[model samples]
Target chain A: MFSNDSQIGDFVKSAPKPKNEKERLAALKRLEILDTLPEQSYDDITKIASYVCQAPIALVSLIDGDRQWFKSRVGLDATETPRDIAFCAHAILEEELFYVPDSSKDERFADNPLVTGHPNVAFYAGAPLETAEGHRLGTLCVIDNKPRVFTDEQKDILTMLSRQVTQLLEYRVINENLKRETKIAKTMTRFFENSQDLMCVAGTDGFFKEVSPSFTEVLGYAVSELLGRPFLDFVHKDDIALTIKEVGKLAQGHRTVNFQNRYQTKDGRWLILSWTSSPSADGSTIYAIARDSTVEIQKQNELLKSYEEIKATRAELVRPKEEAIEASNAKSRFLANMSHELRTPMNAILGYSDLLIEEIDSSQPAVIEDVKKIKSAGDHLMRLINEILDLSKVEAGKMGVSRDTFKVAEVIGQVEGLVRSLIGKNQNKLAFDISKAPAAFNTDQEKYKQILINLISNSAKFTKSGNICVRVFEDNAAGVALMVTEISDSGIGIPTDKLESIFSEFSQVDESTTRLYGGTGLGLSICRKFADILGGKLSVKSELGKGSTFTLRLPSLAAKKSKSSSSQAPSKKGSKRAA
Target chain B: MKRVLVIEDNEINQDLIARRLVKKGYKVDFAIDGEKGLQLIESLQPDIVLLDMNLPVMDGWQVAEASKVNPKTKHIPIIALTAHAMAGDREKTLAAGCDEYQSKPIVFDELMKKIEKCLGSV
Candidate 1:
């Protein structure tokens, strides 16, 4: 009487339209289920049922107002089917079992669209699905792509499991309906009362519906104070436009995550906010959460400040090295050019001075005096050039030091001989207070002699017509002390304030003293450098209107020899060969 | 009078040294450069040569080498005059065939001593 192509109620033309149509409608309506997202609990049951029944497909079908919808399905990807054509609709018409052992051969199913095509109900069986109230809504069914048979025992098991599915559906309808109402109320309460973050529900029109206590704690405003106000009223004026734009996105079903902004507190202080928000139903109410981010923002600001400082210090540090290199290069270039210029002129002076001294008659006093003056000037000029070159070499870090064991007294005698003429000419009384210097100390005798001569000359030049004192003393522990004093009527004492910087290169007590004394300001600087090279320090103590005392303290030769290699023979040979 | 050749580029230095040698009872010949000095030594056959290390045209080292090569001039003593007192300069001059070397701002007494030593050696 029925073709496979006919739908569930199609057989109703011959059989009185299965008695519980009204009751089935009531059961489907009471379930109140349609168009819901898949739940894992229901989906897992369908998967277990298909595995147990050894069927490839299983579904929890709920008959809705106008459709048979799947809450969950194991093999099907669709959500709903038209109620008029649903097979589960016919399965629900049966009392105990509705089974089609060979759907392809069955007169009722052979020509059915679903049986002939996909889902191809070639073998089928179903148990009537019912609620606890005895309302049959759908079926729990197994389907096969080919013809199959089911024993009576398999039919009993299918009916029992389908009855369990119906009970679960009834229980879920009652329980979830209560849960939905209660969850909505609790979510609304949590949106205001118990959140750690300052949360709020605001309308799309910018009015606040609710706010959490954390809002009052963080912003110093009560819920009542903010409830009726436009949300923009609490927003910092500078942040209002941005806040409006972000709020607009939330109303369009888009959620804003970590959208930071600022708000004005009741006391007019700005509070920084890191906020996230989403739109509720009707797209009118905005659910938002906010954290006070001012501390993090301050830290960010401090980090940026430190970064800028580091950049400045990096530039500052790099500039000096470049400048030092440039200055050294400039000095080197100047020295090379100056050596050529000055040497050429010095050649003439030395050569002519030598010749003039020899040519001048011993009998003629004026000619001898003229030769003497020329020789003196030439000697002075040569000394100046030598000093300049030596200082340059020291500055360039190329000055060579030769250590040798020579008698201190012997060096003193050499200096005396060299300056014998100057001493006699100056008529300055010379006094020597030698401790007889501890049995002739061994040192770099040449450098010691050079230092002595410089010191003596300075003393003699600065002082006039007074006793010049030279003293040599020794300590068993500390090395040696050579002191020179030139007492004079001039009374040009170095001031106390400028004494500390006096030993520095190119520094003098004052410009007036420099002008009067006529010095290159390199003597004391050279002395200090030499003392430092010898592992000693040179210092000065002075008082205004009183003579300054300069002290040079150096390690003795014994210490130096212990520290360095005992290679005096080669060094002496080198120095003598150089001279 | 013993003959002496003074090789130097500076006019003032040449005039002064020549006049001095003349007064000192020597017949002095002047050469403005090392090449001229070599030519003068070849022609005049002076007893001694006072050579300046820094000279125009040909320097003292080349003149020394040339003088040592010539058998006749090789008999004559040469004293090197240098203003650069750098290390190894004395050995450099001596290695160039100078009999003696002296640093300049030349104290006449020192130069006289070296010159006499060179003369006595030759």
Candidate 2:
């Protein structure tokens, strides 16, 4: 009943035959299936039928043009068999239940390939599957290796279950189509809501028809405000013509790639925008998305402003330092000029005084007295000029610190000798107190001695009577302490309020003291500057009209003590002055 | 005899230094300002020029440069005299075409040594 073609051959042709040609054709169409895809609803039923009947083969079969095709199978895996030898085709034709019992014993079935090979119709059963329209589509059937018998109740239930199986397959096909629709809807909704850029659809007349939430969120406009409004109305006036040209191209179904321009916000600010537009098939709308670049534009402007400010401030700051240096250089030049004029006359005064001292007789009292006054005044002037020169050298950073080493005792002696003339002239009683001294120390001995001389001289100049004490001592605690102080009688002491200020350049207790004492007021300041350079300190403590004491502290070095040069220099001076 | 040109504005300083140079047997010439110094340099062709850096009508720097450039007077060596002991003044004065730099109140012995060196080298 299944075969008109011979590809499946005599293996299927010698089996069961359809009782009539009309029944054979009816059997073929009764399956009501051709080129149908397999479904699990029917396939599962066949699997269960094979297991329950304890057969090695089962099929849910539908007949095709030349063979019976399987919709589902448990053991037999072929999709089709030739029509002439199809056992299921014959079974499907019969209205009553069809069964083959023990094919090896029945003469008609013995030589059949269904008994000997593929189907081996030793046992078989088929119940037709009828669709809702009463079109029989296929069958649920089973097979067994040994003959199987079915009771009346079993046959009725098998046919009823087969009908139920057909209904479930049809339902599944309808459900698959529904699930496809739901998935497509879900995907489209996600694409619309989750996009980051502003997306919109506009009509051919240039009115916005649809816009994403990003449009309202980014531009601070609502859908009700934008809907049906001409899209160009929101564009910056300068960008309107360009946008119109791009939109015209968009209407021709030509996609605009990265078209960029500005659009004005409701707040009257222009926002930079870049977007691509695509024309829909109907040519009635444009689909586009844009990025807002206003924040980036504002940030770039702010950076440029700050850079300009920094450049301006940089020039403003550098100008003062240069000017200050130039002013200092100018001051040094003036000092150098004055020093030249002052020194020439000062040399003449000292030179003529030297000649006068030799020529004048000491026995002639008035002549000696007048010569003494000139020599003394000239000596004072020379000291003043020296001080001016020293201050200038220090300010210009030209003064060199001598590297020669000397004994602390030698420095103390030199300080005493240097101030002796000042002390004698000031009429101050002076004392020498030596607690201890390192035999020698390494330092710029010349500068060290000069520092001592200046401090002591200033002290002597201020003090008129009482006593001046020179004390030398060493401290392992830090370095060394040398105190050369004046305990004096006839002058007012430094005010406590002016103690720190006295170390400042050109500072004096009052304007009167500068006039009365006749000082450049640079002595103490130069001493302190020198002390600072020595990494030491010079300090004073005084009682008005009683006296003042000045102390100089220095650092000590322990190693390389065999500095014979320093020892020798101090010993010569120390012995000569010890008397 | 070596010739000396003293360019100075101050009569006292100029007389003091020039009298000492004349006593030492050098022929001395003088200019009161930078412009006169250049004029004197060309006409006198002195062996050594003592230039005061500060003067009216173009300072010593301008005088030294003009004197050093003129072919007729450029052979004369100049000693720059400055009253300022400022840093870099020496360098600047030398760079302006003075053969040496010395600060004043002029140490006669030191100034003489520098002058002799410039004259011997020239």
Which stretches of candidate 2 lie above 4 Å from their native place? A1-187, A190-197, A200-210, A213-262, A270-399, A407-420, A433-435, A479-491, A556-579, B1-122
lDDT string, candidate 1, A218-267, tens digits: 88888788886887988887888998999888888889899988898888
Q: DockQ score of candidate 1?
A: 0.27
Docking class of 2: incorrect
Q: After superposition, how far is residue A185 of candidate 1 from its true place, in Å?
A: 12
List, residue by residue over B14-84, the lDDT tens digit for candidate 2.
87787678868999888999898889999888898899998999899999998888888788899999865
lDDT tens readout by residue for model 2, A321-343: 98988887677666756765677
Interface Cα RMSD, each model: 3.8, 6.4
lDDT of 1: 0.73
Clashes of each: 6, 13
